[model samples]
Target: MTTYLPPEVQAGLDDARKRALKKSQRLSVQAGEETFRVLEAWDDGFALELAVADHLRGMVDLYDGPTLLSQCLIVASEEDGDQMRFEYKRMTEATGEQPVDFEKPENAPVALIGKG
Candidate 1:
């Protein structure tokens, strides 16, 4: 079956992809027992939610420019009219680890376009 995402969600994802390409940097996030790169991010109004694969080990890290922020998980397209939300508890747990591998092309999430 085809997965259908809300229009807002799609727009958020698209914005994230553009941002990632423009920065030319990969993001690392921890899921369960591994670290993975967030192929793309979806705007959820609060924070930018990332679409991640594998690398699910400890906690997720979000790097913007020279600053690196940690969070448990990134949620996208939240109804709160925000970009994303970070779970502080999870982020504090994982520290000092190798960067996760972000599988490009195949693992990338779909971007969305905001209306009005």
Candidate 2:
């Protein structure tokens, strides 16, 4: 059966959905001793803007779960009632291994001829 909701009812439903999304979709970032809930997140970093809080500056480290993401610098922060927006760039390269040490010699490859 095709049923239609009233315009008012539909609008209310949409508003509810939006709120639910915000409630569920949030991350956290460590700012000084306190951790602020991330209102929005991205590949580079997360964002938190509010009037009352310890000012975030310099390098802001973002994390996903317990894993730390690339460090980001506070490239931009506007003070509007302490309103600040930080745009960041990934600092560390994605390479799994640590930066190569030119001073260290390469280990000779071992042959496993007999062992499976």
lDDT of 2 by residue, 23-59 (tens): 7654556656776656566565445655433367666
Of the candidates shown, which would achieve the greatest lDDT relative to the real structure?
2
Give the top-scoring candidate (TM-score). 2
- The list of candidate 1 runs beyond 4 A from truth reads 1-23, 45-59, 63-67, 74-116
Against the correct fold, how does model 2 do in TM-score?
0.51
List, residue by residue over 1-116, the lDDT tens digit for candidate 1.
98999999999997886576545545545445554444444442123333433112234556544356555554332322322333243333335766679645876668977898
Query: Candidate 1: TM-score?
Result: 0.26
